[model samples]
Each structure stands twice: as C-alpha cells, then as structure tokens.
Target: MSTRSHSAVMLRRNFKHVARNPTSVFNAVLMPIVMMVMFVYMLGDAFSVGVDYVDYATPGLMLMAVCYGLGAVATAVNSDLTKGIINRFKVMDVSRGAVLTGHVVASVLTNLIAIAALVAVAFLLGFSPSAGLFDWLGVVGLVVLLGLAAGWFTVALGLAAKSPETAGLASVPLVMLPFFSSAIVPAEKMGPGLREFAEYQPFTPVIETLRGLLAGAPSAGDAIAAVAWCVGIALVGYLWARAKFSKRA
Candidate 1:
C-alpha cells in the first residue's frame, strides 16, 4: 500500500482506540470548558484587559485547547510503542510516517472539535468576535498549523518517554505554557520579570495573532512570527520523531 493508504489504515485504527478510551477526549475537550467557566466566571472580574474578559480570553482559551489536547497524542503514541504495536507494524512493513501521521491528524481533528465546542460555549457566555469570513479562515489555518506542529512535537515526546504514564507527564509543559501567556490577562499586567517572558514566549505571538484575527485586525508581524514558530517546531519535531522511530522500530 502507498503511504497515504497505510496512513488511512493507521488513522482508522487510532480512532478506534480513541472510541474505546475517551479519557483523552475529556482532557482535551471538557477540561478547557471547565477552565473557561472558571476564568470567565470565577476569576474574570479580577482582570482589567481592555475588552470583555470573555472576548479577551476566548482566543487564549482556543490556543490552550490546542496545547492541552497534545497529551493524548503523546500518550497514544507511547501506548503503541510500549505495547509493541509499532514492532508488529514493522514486521508488516508499515511506514513510520504513516504511523505518526495517523496520530498527528487524529490529534488535530480532536483539537478542532474541542475548539468548536469551546467557541460555542464562548458565544453562550457573551463572547462576541468582530471576525468576518476571512478572519475565521485565518483562525482555522493558524490553529491547524499550530496543531500540526504541536502534534508532531508531542508524538516525539511519546516516542522518547520511558512509558505511557511518563508520556502524559511529558506533555505538562504544553498544558502549562498558556497560563503564563497572555491567556488570562494582558501580558502588560504581569509583573516586570514575568511580563518580558510572556511577551516573547512562542505561545504569545500565536495567541496575539489569533486575538487579532478575531478582532478583525491581525498584526502582520505577529502572523509572521507565529508561522515561523510553527514551521520551526514542526521541522524539529518531524526530524526528532523520525530519528527516534528509526532507532526504536
């Protein structure tokens, strides 16, 4: 079978696994909504971002949804590795790209679903965006780009982890990075030492670009930086994952 065909087969198998075990889905989907409610209700009034707390926070939450969803990708890939699923596929002549592609695409799809659900809840919470058709398209494109990049990175983490449990733990940084970002409040609101860090961290530009798109006035500089970060991470992740898979399988 062609790589595409092999990838499709792997994709189906991965989805089946997800269907049987929905823990990751809850982590990726429900956890963000919980956080959203917590932020917009329990904690929103404490901040003074220029816009509605919901509106300001929605973009950040969307980015968090992507970051938070990566644990599943790592865990799923680790499960396959430790269970000798990849070794079995190796004997059957399955391509490495096919295996990882299945995880990456599936991760991206699940994250999109989570984002959609989050957006729905955001609307219900009085989150209103100035984005138009093009703006929405930009949002999707950027989210997918980030998802693809982070998916591969987490897949590499899974490959590198000692076990499935460790793989879940390995993804903690991705989950935590957004909190330190402009997600909950404006970066300027943070104290001086932390503010500088928040301004330059990878997630910041991406979140800012996303916020800009939703507001119908995205910054070109931020978009450039965001794309550059995504591309660099994806390349590093693909190469690292390929090397690890080659050695193991």
Candidate 2:
C-alpha cells in the first residue's frame, strides 16, 4: 500500500480509539471551559482594564486548550510504543513514517474540534471578535499550525519517554506554558524578568497574533514570528521523533 493509504488506515484506527475512549477529548474540552469561566467571572473585573476580560482572554484560552490537548497525543503515542504496537507495525509491510503521521493528523483534528467547542462557549459567554472573513481564515490557519507544532513535539516526547506515565508528565510543561505567557495577562503587566521571558516565549507571539487577528488589529510582526516558531518546532520535532522511532525499531 502507498504511504498515504497506510496513514489513512492508521488515522482511522486513532479516530476509532478516540470514539471508544473519549476521556482525553472530554478533558481537552473541559479545561478550556472551566478556565474561561473562572478567568471571566472570578478575575474579569480586575483584569478588564476597560476591555472585556472574556474578549481579552478567549484567544489565550483557545491556545491553552490546544496545548493541553497535546497530552492526549503524548499518552497515545507512549501507549503504542510501550505496548509494542510500533514494533508490530515494523514487522509488517507498512510505511514507517505513516505511523507518526497518523497520530499527528488525528491530534490536529482533535485540537481543532476542541478549539471549535471553546469558541462556541466563548461566544455564549459574550466573547465577541470584530474580525472579518479573511481574519477568521487566518485564525484557522494559525490554530492548525500551532496544533501541528505542538502535536509533533509531543510525539517526540512520547517516544523519548521510558513509560506512558512519564510521557503524560512530560506534557505538563506544555499545559503550564500559557500561564507564564501573555495568554492570561498582558506581558507589560508582568515584572521585568517575567515580562522579558513571557514576551520572548513561543506561546506569547502565537497568543498575541491570535488576539490581534480576532480583535481585528492584526500584528504583522507577531504573526510572522508565530509562524516561524511553529515551523521551526515542527521541523525539529519531526526530525527528532523520526530518529528516535528508527532507533527503537
């Protein structure tokens, strides 16, 4: 079979697993909803500073959801690795790259769905964006790119981990990164040291770009930086994961 066919088959397997066991999807959807509510109601007034906190926070929450969802990808890949599914595939006639590609594609799809659900909830909670058609397209593209970068990185982490538990734990940092970024608050509001770190981190530029696009004030510089970060991460992660998988096989 062609590599594309092998990937499609593996993709269906991953989707079936998601259908059968949906705890990961539930967590991905729930985390953002809970965070959005807490941020908007508990700290909205203080953080609003004239603009609606929901509006200010929705982009961050969306990005956070995508990042958090990477845990599921890590866990799934780790499970397959530790359980010898990858080894079994190696013995069969299949494209080696398709195994990782399948997981990455499924993960991107899952994150997109999670993002859609989060956006729906945000709209219900009075999070309105002034963006037009082109801007919305840009938002979609940004989300997919971010998902690909994060998902691929998690795949590398999963393969590198000695156990599934370690893989899940390894992804904790990805989930926590938004807290230190402009996701929850403006970097300028942070102190000197933290502000510098937050401003330069990968998540910040992505969040800032998303905020700009959704708010109808696109930041060309931030958007470019965010794309560059995603591309760099995806390339590194793919190469790392491919090397690790080959070594294991």
Clashing pairs in 2: none
Off by over 4 Å in 1: none
Indicate the residue-level lDDT of 131 in model 2. Answer: 94
Backbone clash pairs in model 1 (N, Cα, C under 3 Å; residues 3+ apart or in different chains), count: 0
Q: What is the C-alpha lDDT of each candidate?
A: 0.91, 0.89
> Largest lDDT belongs to which candidate?
1
Q: Write the per-residue lDDT of candidate 2 for residues 1-249, one digit (tens) a residue.
A: 899999999999986776566678676777788888899867788784457888889899989989867777888898998899988888897788899999899888888888898889888889889999999999999999998999889999999998989998999999999999998889999999999999999999999899999999999999999999999999999999999898876
lDDT of 2 at 221: 99
Q: Highest TM-score, which number?
A: 1
List candidate 2 stretches off by more than 4 Å. none
Score every model by TM-score.
Answer: 0.97, 0.96
